[model samples]
Target chain A: MSLDTRPPRQTPVRHVATPRERDEQRGLPTRSLLLALVLACITLMVVDRTSGEDSPVEPVRRVVGEVLGPAEAGVNAVLGPVLGLPEMLRTNDALREEIAAQDDEIAELRREAHQNPYDVARAEDLRALCAMATNTGYLLAPARFSGYSSAQSFSSTISIDAGADAGIRPDMTVVNGDGLVGRVLEVTSHTSTVLLIVDADSTVGGKLGESLESGFVDGRGGLADGDPLDLRLVDNTVLPEQGQQVVTWGSEGTGPYVAGIPIGEVSKVYEDIRAGTYRAVLEPYVDFTSLGDLAVVVPTGEDTRVIEPEACS
Target chain B: MRGNSRLVAALLIVVTALLVQVTVLPHLAWNGVVPDLVLLSVVGAALVTDPRFATLLGFGAGLLLDVAPPADHAAGRWALALLVVGYVVARLAHDYQAAQPGPQPASTPRPPYLLMLVAGAGGAFVGTSLFALTGLLLQDPAVGVGALLEVVLAAVAYDALVAAVAVPLVVWVFRREPAPRVAHVLR
Candidate 1:
C-alpha cells in the first residue's frame, strides 16, 4: 500500500494524549496546588519572623496551646511513671547515695523526736527554693511543668502549669529544687512557657562564686547531644578552675534571672586559639530532662531598692 | 465517601503523631534528638494518597507541628519542609506505580518494604535539611552549625527507624480499602 493511501495506515500511536491522560501520566499531582502551598508556607515563615510578638500566627499558636495544654497534662499524668523510668535509671546511683545519707538523718531525727514530742513536724519540700526565696526576699509562685517544647524544635522550652492567673509573668526567673531551670518566656491565663538555660538562644550573666569572675553563660543548645553550657568570661585572662560554682550575676530590675541562683559548675576550661579566649564549660545543676516542680519569682511590689544584693551562698 | 474517609484517616494519624512527639518523645530521646513523627506521618500519607492530597497533608501536618506548643521556630518552617517531602514522595510513588506493566487491581499491592524505607529516609533528610537551612537563614538556629548537623543526622536515622514501623501501619490502614483513585491511574 502507498504510504498515505492504505486505509490511512493508522498513524503510529500519536502520543498526543488528552489533558486527562497527561495528568495521569504524571500521577495526578496538581503542580499549581503544590506551588501555592509552598508559597503559603514561605509567607507564613516570613510573617512569623518579621512580626515578632504581633505575628498572626501567635493567636493560632495560643489556640493550639489552649487546646493541647490540658490534653498534654492528661497524657503526662498517665505517662508520668513510664517517663520517670529513664531518669530513675540514670540517677540510680545518686538516689542510692541519697537514701543512705537520708537514713542517718532519719535516725537522728527520730532521736530528736524522742527528746522533743512537739518537734515532729516534717520539713517542707523544695527547701532550697524556699530558702533562696526567703534569703532574697522575693515572692515565689510554685508551679509544675505541664509540657516540654516539641522534640522537633531547636529551642529548649517548657510549659508550666501556672500563668497570669497565678501571677507568673514573662522574664520571671524559674527555679526548682536543684538550681536555675529557666526563665518565663511568655504567659497565658493558666500556663507559661519557660526558656531553659540550656538553650543556645539563651544567655545569662553568671559569676564564679569564689573568684567572682563574671562571664556570659550560654547554652550549647545540644542538650540532646549532652553538650554543656559555655561560659565566656569578660576577663579572658582569668581561667576558672574546674569545680568552680557558677551563679546568675543578676539582671536589671531583677527580671529574667535574679542574682545568686546557682547556674552550674565549671566542668572543663579550655582556651580557643583562633579567638584568643578562654572558655569554661559548665554542667548545669538543674536536671533539665527530669524537671518537675518549679517556682517563678514574682515581684512582691516591695521596695526592691532597699533589698540588698545577696549571693546565693 | 471513600476519599473523605481517607482524608480523615490521614488527619488522625498526623495529629496523633504530633501529640506523641511533643508529649512522650522528649523523654525517649537518644542523645537529645527525638524522632520526627509528624514528618513520618506525612511520608506515610504520601505513600497512600494522591500527590495533591499528600502535598496538602504535608503542609497541614507541618503547620500543626510549627504552631504546636514548644515550637518556637518560625511558624512555616516545618510546613514548608514537609510540603516538599509530601509532594516529592507522592509524585515518586505515583510515577513508580504508573510505570508498572499491567493494570493495577482495585486492591493495590503494597510497595516493596525497601522502596518504602528509601522513600521515608529521603523524605526525612530533605525535610530536616530544609528546616535547618531555614533556621539558619532566619538567624534563629537553635544550635550552632556543628550541633545542627548532628541533630539533622540523628533526626534522619531516628525518623527512618520509626517510619519502618509506622509507615507500614499507615499503608495497611489506607490501602485496605479498594483504592479507586489508584486503580484509575493504572488503567
Candidate 2:
C-alpha cells in the first residue's frame, strides 16, 4: 500500500463553460441562414443599383409599396395637420422677413383699397386675366407630399400622393409657392417620387434673374440641411453676383423642368479658369425641410415629345 | 418559419416607427434633421434579443424601408447598415451581461442610461455612415463631406436624445423574463 506500483489515475480537468461554449451549449446559430440572408441583401443592392426600372426587386418593392403606401397615406392624412403644427410654429429669419414683406404689401394694398377702390378692383381683374393667359402655356396639377425619402441620411426625394392615376409621368417638374422643388423621378399607380432640384444628380437649364446669363444648374443635394444649389456657368465671361436670382431655362419642349421656375439665388461664385466655367452656389427659394403642397408641371395636352432621361438607379 | 409573436410584435413596432418617421418626423424636423425611429427600434430589440433574430429584424425592416417610396438609393443599403447595427447592439448587450458574474445588491445603482447612450450614438453612426459610404463607393458623391458631417452629427445627436425614451421601452417590451435578483432598470 505504501508503494503503489501504478501511478494514481489522473483525474481529467473539465473545461470551464466560456461564453462561446455556453452559446454553443444553448445552440449554434445556423450559419447558412445568415449567409443566405446577407448574400441576398447584397445581391439585391447590387442588382437594384444596376437595373433601372427593371430589377427583379421591383416586384417586391411594388408589392411593399402597394401594401404599405395606402396605409401610410391614410395615417399621414389623418395626422398630417395635427403633426404639422410643430413645424408651422418654428419659423426662420427668412419666414420672418417674408411675413414683414407681406405686411408691407398688405399695407400698400389697404392704402390702394381705400384711396382708389374701383381702380384697384379693375387692376386686379386685369391681373387675373393676365395670369390666366400666362398659365395657359403649362398644365399644373397640385399634389401633397405624402412621405419623405426613407433613408434621410443619403437620399433626397419625397413621395407625392398623386401619380400615374393623376396623370403624373416621370420627369415632370414639381414646384411650390416658393420656387422649383424638384422633378418627378418615378411614378407608380397612385404615388410618385420627386427628386428635388437640390439632389446631386439633378440638372436643369437655368438663367440668372438679372444678367440673364445661362448655365446648367446642378444640385449639390444639400437642400435638406442647407447645402446650397450649384449652378455651372456656361459663359466664362460672366460671374453671377451673390443673391442674384436664378430661374430655370426650359428645354426645347416639356423637359424635366420647364423654363421660368425659380431655382435659387446665387450665394457664392467660384470660377474654374481651366474649365472656363464658374460654379455658383445658390440659396434655393424653397425650404425643402417644410415641403407640403407641390404642383407637378405637365405639358398642356398630349404632346408626349418630352423624352424622360433615365436617372441613375 | 419566422412566426414568433415577439418577433412579429417587434417587427410591427419597427414598421409603425418607420411609418411615423416618414409621415410625422418631417413635420417634427428641427434644422432639417429627424430621428431614425427604426434605428432606435433596432437598438431596443437588440438589447433583448439574440444576434440572429436582431440581424434578421434589421435586414427585414431595412428592406421594407428601402423598397418603400422616397427611397432614392439601392434596395439594400439600409439593410446592410441595419444588419451591422443590430449585430453590434446584440453583441454589446450580450458581452455586458456575460461580464457581470452575478447580480448586484439592491443598494447598488443599476445604470442603463449609460448603455442606452452608447447604443444610440453607435447605432446611428454605424447606420448613417454606412449609408453614406455606400453612396461614395457607388461613385455617387451626392453631398460634400461637410454636408455629410452635418447630417451625421444631427442624426447622431437626435437619435441619442430619442434613445433614452426608445431603448428602455423596446427592451422592456421584448424581453422574455427577468433574471432572479437582477432588478431590471426598464421598469
Candidate 3:
C-alpha cells in the first residue's frame, strides 16, 4: 500500500557469514594475534639468552635447588644401605683381599725405606708438600660431587656442592688427594662447576721429574676409543716417558695448586709425524668418574711467595 | 585433594631424583653415561598435569637440578626452558584431545600415544641443549654439541623409560570420572 504512494523503502541486507568467518571470530586475531605471539616469542628468547648469562638468578636457583638437596641426600643415604646389601655379602672376602694387598704394599715400602732411604725421604717430602699446600692460608672449602657430563663433545667436568657462598671463586684451583682436578669456571650461591684438566680446552704448565723437561699439557677431546683422557706435550724439548710423574709448575704463583701436587703419570708417549711433538696421554690421579668429595682452594695470598721465580725456573 | 599436598609430593620427587643423579648415578655410570632421573620426573609430571601446574613443576625441578651440583650454567635457564616445555606438552595434549573428541566405544582400544612420548623426549633434549648452550654462551666455549647431544639422548632414553611406567600410573591417578547416566523406563 505504501508503494502506491512512494518508492519502496530500501533496507540494508546483512552479509551472510561463512564458516571461516565464524572460526575467525571464535579464534584470535590474525595480524594482532601474530604480532602478540611474535612479541612473546622474542621476549622469551631474550629472557632465555639473558638468563643464560645473568648471575643474579643464583639465589632463586639456590632456593629452588634446596628442594632437591635433602631428597638427594636421603636417596643417597638410602642407596648406601641398598648398595651395602651386596657389599655386605662380599665383605669378608674383600676384607681378606684388601688386608693382603695392604700388607704387601707395606712390606714393599719398608724394603724400599731400608734399601733406598731416598724413597722414604721422597714420601716424607710429598707429605710435607701436601701439608704446606694446605697451610698456605688458602681457605679450603669442602665440596660434594654433584654431576658430570658424559658427553665427549665438551670437556670433562664435574659439579660440586659448594658455590660462591662458600667463597669458591671462578678460576680457583680444585684438588683431591692426588693433585689438580681442574679450576672453578662458574659459581652459584650454592654450587660451582669445575672444568677438569682432561677437558679439550684445558691447558696447564707441567714438568717431568727426571729431566726437569717442561711443556704444556693440552686436552684432546674424545681420546682414542675413549680411553678416559689424552694430554698432548706441546714442546718437543721435553719428552715425557710412560710412568714419569707430571706436576703443576705453579709458575703463575697460584698456590692453591702447589708445585709438586701429583697430577698424573704419563700413560703413553708417541711421536706425532704431523705435529712433530710427542703426544703423551695422562691418566689423572684423581679418578673423576668415582670422585665423591673435593676441596676448593681459595686464594689467601699467603702462598703467593711459595712459587718464587727462582724455584719455577 | 589439597593443592599443597600435590606440590609437596612433586617437590619431594624432584629432590630425590637430584640426589640420586648426583650421588648414586655417578657410581652407576655406564661408560661415563648416567641416566637423567630429574628429566624423567619432569616429563612425567608435565604429561599428567595442567599447563600452569606443569610449568611450575618444571621450573621447580629444573632449579633443583641447577643447584644440586657442579654449577655450570647460570641459574633460571633450566627453569625457563622447562616451563616452556611443560606448557608446550600440555597445549599439544589439549589440541590432540580436542580433535579426537568423544568417549571410546566399549569395543575400541586406545590409540597409540607415541607422539606424546616423542614430544616428552624431544622436550628433554631441548632442555639439556639449552642448558649447555646457555653455559657456553655465558661462561665457557668448551660446551660441545657432541656432548650436549649425548646428554640429550641419555635424557630422552631415561625419560622414555619413566614415561612408559609412570604414564599409566598418572592416568589412573588423574583419570576423570564418567558422567552420570539417566535411564528411561518404558512401562
Candidate 4:
C-alpha cells in the first residue's frame, strides 16, 4: 500500500467513516494479500517438513544462527549480571557466611591436593567430563551454552558456541558433567543446535545400569528443564525398582550416543495393564534449566595403535 | 520523513522484542513458557498502523521467530501463526474504530488498554494453538493433549500480562505517525 501524505487542513473533519470506507480509502491490507501471505507460509512449511536433512530452509536457518548467535551472546553478557541481581541479593548473606566457612575448607583441601597433586587445575564440571571422556575413550570438543530455542514451550533445544568449526556435526552426542544432555541436531559455522533429551520427540536407547535390561527412554515435552522421562523396557517381566541407575545403551557407530553415559535414576515404576508392559520414570542427571558448559563427543575411528610383543624379545 | 521514522521505530521495536524473546525471556519463563514478545509487538503495531502494514509486520516477525536459532520445528509455522494474529488484530481495531460514535481527534489517541489485553490474549491463543496444531498434524511428536492445553492457556495469560507494558511501548513509538485513516481523509 502506498503511503498517503495528506496536507494539514484548517479544521478537523467531524464526519464518522464506516469501516469499509476507511479500509478502501486507506488501501489497507485486502483479502488477497492476506491469503497470499498465508499461502507462502504453508508452502514454506510443506517444503521444510518433507525435505528432511537437506531442506531449503537449512541455509536460511544457518545464516540466521551465524548472524544472531554473537548478538545474543553479547546481549546475554551485558544482561547476565542484571538478570542475576535478584538471586545474588537473595544469597548475599549466605554467601558471606560461606566465605568464612570456605576459607577453612579451602585451606584443608589445598593441603590435601598438594600431597597428591595431578591435574587438579580443571573446574569440577570439566574434570568430571574429562573423566567420562577418558573412561569412554571418545574425543570431546567442549562448548558453551549460548541460547535456547525460542519455542521453549513446544520443543526443547539449545544452541552452543561450538559447531562445525570445532569439528561438531549433526547427531554427535552432547553430554555435560552429570549425564547426557542431547545430540547435535543442526550445525553452522560457529554454532549448533542440540536437541535436549527432555524434548517430547526425543527417544534414546537406555538400559538399567546394573541388570543391563534395555529400554527406550522417551522425553516428556512439556518442560525444558529436567522434566521426567518415560522409560519403556523391552522385557515385560523385568520388574525394575526405584533408584536403579539408567545409562545409554550406545548407538551402532556411536554417532548419536555413546555407551555408559549416565542418564538418570528410576524414580517410579508402573505396569501398563492393557498393554502388559512395564514403564519407569527417570529423573535426568543434567540440570536443564542451568545448562552451561557442555562437551560434544566426536568418536575416534577404530584404534590403529601397533602392539609390540615385549616378552618375545 | 514521517514514514521513515515510523519504519525505523517499528523495526527497532520488533527486533528488540525478538532479541529479548530468544535471549533473556527464557530465563524468566514461568512454567517453561516464555511470553511471546514478538506477538505482543505486532499487536501494538497493529493498533496504530494500516492493516496492510500490520499483516506484513506479523509475517516478518513470525518468519524471524521460525528461522531463529534452536527452532527445530517446521520453518513456516510461526509465520502462519503471526500472519493470522496481525490480520485479526488490525481488523478488530478497525471495526472498533468504526463503531465509535464521533470523529476521532486529529491527534492519535492512546491505544485502548482493554482492546490490547483482549488482542494479546486472543492473538496468543490463536497463534500458539495454530503452531502447536500444525506440529501435531505433521507427526512431529508434539506434546499430548493435556500438555497442549497447558501451553495454550499459559501462553495466553503470559502474553496478556506482558502486553500491558509492551503494547503501550510500541504504541508510543508509533505515535508520531498520523493515524492512517485520518491522514487519508485529510488528503
Candidate 5:
C-alpha cells in the first residue's frame, strides 16, 4: 500500500514556558522562591523523621544510591587497606601476645587430632547440629564496609558493599563472629547503609546471657568514647550483674534486627526507681570505629552468604 | 569572571570537596573531628559570590550530603542549616567589602585573611550547631551537648585552617566582572 501522505492533523499546541522565560519572570515572589525552598526542606525533614522506615523518599534515595554505591565501594576497596595500616601497627603488640596464646592452643588441638578418628567424626556431626539449631532462623549475607557518614559527631553509619543484589534489605540484622554490629538502614541495588549499634537512635531488644532477662538496648553514638551503648531492663524482680553478656531477642524475620546475635557485656548497672528499669552500660564486642566486614541476617529458606559457621569450618 | 565560569567553578569546588571528604578525610579523623571541606567551600563561595546565589548553593550542597549514603538524620536538616550559614557569611562579606575601597580592576581586592578566617569559624560553628540542634528536635541526636560543643570548637578550628588555603582560590575562580564606580546610598 502506498504510504499515506497527508498533512498530519494539527496537534493541539500547549504553551509550555521555556526555562529562560521562567527565569525572566521577575514578578515571582521571593517569599515563595527561597523561603519556600527552606520550608519544603523542613517539611520533608518532618515527614521523613516521622515516617521511620517507610519514608516516602526511600525509593528516590534508592535510585541515587544505586548510582553512587558501586563507585563508593570501589574507592573504599582501594583505600581501606592502605588506611588501615596505622591501626594495624598500633595493635601489633596486642596481637603478638594473643598469637602466643593461640599457638599453645593449636599445639594442644593438634595432639588431640591424632587420638580418635571415630570421635572426631562424631564431634563434627554434633557441631553441625549445634550450628543448625543456633542459626536456624538466619540466612546471612556478607558485606564489606565501604564508607562512613561524613558528618562530624552528628551521625554514625557505614555503607556496605552489598545490597539488594545480595538479598540485603533495610532493617536486616547485621553481625560479625564476635557479636552484633548493626542493621541495614537503607539498601540500593549493590550497596546498603548500616546504622551501627553505637548510633544514638539505634535501639534493639536484648536479653542477658545468664539470667535471660530481656529489655531494650540503645546506642550512644560514641565515636572515640570507649563506651557508647546502654541496656535497660524493666523487670523489677531480676537483678543484672556486671560482665553478663547481652544478646538480641530475635525480632520478626522481616523486622529491623534478627535474634540471638550477641550485643555486648554489661559494664555498669544503676537502679532507676521511677522508670522501673535498670540502666546498664554496654561494652560492645565489635569495635564500631574499625569496621571491616559485616553480615546481614536474611531469613532462612533464602539464598544466603556461603559462610560456614566456625564450629563447622 | 563571567557568571557561567563562576557557576562551573563553584560546582567543581563542591564535587571535589565531596570526593575528598568521603575518600581521604576519613583517614584524617582525629578523635572524631574530621574537617568539614564542604562547609569551608560554602563559606569561601559566600565570601566572593552574591548572597542569594551562595545561599541556594549551600542548600543544594547540603541536600546532596543529607541524602547520600551513611547519612542517618532526616533529609533536609543539613540543607536548612547550611542555608542559614551561607546567608550569614555572604552578608558579612558584603558588609566587609562596603567598608573598604580598592583600585583592582575586574575583581575586588582581597579581604583581610583574618576576616575570611573569622567568617569560616563563624559559619562552621553555626552550621554544626544547627545540624546538632535539628537532629535533637528530630529525636535522632547523633551525640549529646558535650560532644556537640567539642565538635563546634573543632569545626571552627578546622574551617579556619581550610579557609586559609581554600578561600583565596575560590575568590579567584568566582571573581566578578568589573563595574564602574557607583555612588553609595545611605538610607
Candidate 6:
C-alpha cells in the first residue's frame, strides 16, 4: 500500500493545573490504600480466629495439604528401606536374644507348675490379672506417621497415614499398644494429625492405679534438665505414687476419649511446698522416638467397667 | 548447553532435598533434631549464583520447604526471609577476588568467604526466628527463648556444612568455559 502524504492533523492538548484536580487524584489513591489495609487486617483477623477455633475449614486445609502429601509419601517410601536396614538388623539380633531368654523362663515356669499343682493355679491367676490390666480386648487400627510440626516449643503434633477413610475422626483417642498417645485433632481423607500426650496443649484426665485417685495429667514442654514429662497433680486428694500406673478417665460427657487406656507410669513424685499438690513426672508409655506404628482405639459403646476387688470382698 | 542443563539440575536437586527433609528427616531425627537440608541447598545456590537470580532461587527453595509437612507458618514467610539471605550473599560475592569468575567458583580461600558464611548463618537465624515468632503470634505459648535459640543454632550449623560442599560441586558441574586455544603462526 502507498503511504498517504498529507498535512499532519494536531489535536489540541488540554493541561489542567488546578489545586482541586490534583487533590482529587491524590485523595483517590489514599482512600484506596486505606481501604486495602482495612480489608487485609479484617481478613487476617478472621483467618487467625478460625484456625484457633478449630472450625470446619478442614476441607480447604486438606486441599492445600494434598500438594505436599504425595511428595511426603514418596520421601517416606524411599527413605523407609534405607532407614529400616539398620533397625532391621538390630531388631533381628534383639529378637533372637529375647526368644532364647523367654524359652528359659517358660521352661522354669513349667517345671515349677509340675512340682506343685498350686503353682499352676497361681500362674493362671497372674496371667488373667495381666490380661485385664493390659486390656487386650480392645480393637486397634495401626497407623504410620509422616510429618510432625517443628514449631520448637509448641504442642508437638504428628501426621499419620490413617485418616477419615480409615474410620478416624476428630477427638477420637489414639493409643499405642502400651498406652494413650493422644486424640485426633484433624482428619483428612487419607491422613490424620495427632496431638501427642506429651505436647504442651494436651491434657489427659487420669487416675492413679493403686489409690484410684483422679487428677489431670498436663504435658509440661520437654523438660528443662532433659527430665521426663512432669504431670501436675491438679486434684488435692489425688496423690500419685512414684511407680503408679496412670490410666485415662473417660471423656467428660464427650465421646472423644475412652476410659481405662494406660497413659504412663509415674517416674517421680515431688511435693510442691506452696501449692500442697504432688507434681508427678510421667514417662509416657509410648516412646516418641520409636514411634513407627501406632494404634487408634475405636470406641465400642459398651464400657469395660472396672470392678473394685476390695469392694467385692 | 551446560548453563541451561545446570539450572534444570539445580531445581531437581532442590526438589529432592525438600522431599527428603519433610518425610525422611523426621524419621532420621536424633534427639528430636533433624538436619535442615533445604536451608543447606538454598545456601549453596545463593553462594554459587549471581545476585539477580538469588531472590528467585531462594523463593523457589523456601516455597518448597513451606509446602512440606510440619509447616506451621504461612507459605511465604520463609520465601521472603531466604530472598533476603540470597541477596546479601550475592552482594558480598561481588567484593571477593578469592573465587574465580565462572558459573561455579573454584575452591575459594576460607577467610575471604567468611562474609558468605555469616550471611548464611544470619539468614537461617532470621528465618527460624521469624518462624518461631509466627508460632507465638498464633497463640502457641510453648515457644520460648531457649527453644528458638536451639533451632537457630542447629539450622545455621547444618546449612554452613552443606554450603561448603554444595558451592564447590555446583561450580564444577556448570564449568563450561571454552578451553584456551593455542595459536600457531603460518610458516
Please tell me which predicted candidate would have the highest DockQ against the true structure: 4
User: lDDT, candidate 6, residue A80?
Assistant: 71
**Candidate 2 clashing pairs, residues 3+ apart or interchain:** none
The DockQ of predicted model 5 stands at: 0.21
Local distance difference test values of all predictions, in order: 0.82, 0.76, 0.62, 0.82, 0.75, 0.62
Give lDDT tens digits, candidate 4, residues A191-222: 99999988888999999998999999999875
lDDT of candidate 2? 0.76
Q: Is candidate 1 or candidate 3 better by lDDT?
A: 1
Model 4 ranges off by over 4 Å:
A1-22, A87-93, A99-313, B177-187
Cα deviation of A282, candidate 6, in Å: 64
Task: Report the TM-score of chain B alone for all candidates.
Answer: 0.89, 0.84, 0.72, 0.88, 0.84, 0.68
> How accurate locally is residue B136 in candidate 3, as Cα lDDT from 0 to 100?
60
Q: What is the lDDT of residue B106 in candidate 3?
A: 40
Per-residue CA lDDT of model 5 for B20-57, tens digit only, reads 67767877776777778888888888887667678888
- TM-score for the first chain of model 1? 0.55
lDDT of 1 by residue, A183-222 (tens): 9989999899999998889999999999998899998785
Q: What clash pairs does model 4 have?
A: A29-B52
Instruction: Summarize candidate 6's per-residue lDDT along A167-274 as a digit string, tens digits.
Output: 677887776645777889999988998888777777888887777777788876542334346666556746777788888888753236678888888988788789
Q: What digit string (tens of lDDT, one per residue) describes model 5 on residues A1-313?
A: 8998887869866778876555334122244556887897799899988998999867767776776567677787888888878767757778888999999999898878866775665455345333533464455566777888876757788899999988887888877646788888899999998888889998899999888888888988866876788887758657789999998887676568777777889998888788666778889988677665566777655665544444343
RMSD of 4: 33.7
Candidates 1 and 2 compared by DockQ, better number: 1
lDDT of 1: 0.82
Better of 4 and 5 by DockQ: 4
Encode model 6's per-residue lDDT on B84-107: one tens digit a residue.
555555555544543456553343
Of models 2 and 4, which has the larger lDDT?
4
Candidate 5 collision pairs: A250-A259
N/CA/C clash count, model 6: 1
Runs with alpha carbons beyond 4 Å of true place in candidate 3: A1-54, A61-75, A91-313, B1-5, B67-72, B99-120, B136-141, B161-163, B166-187
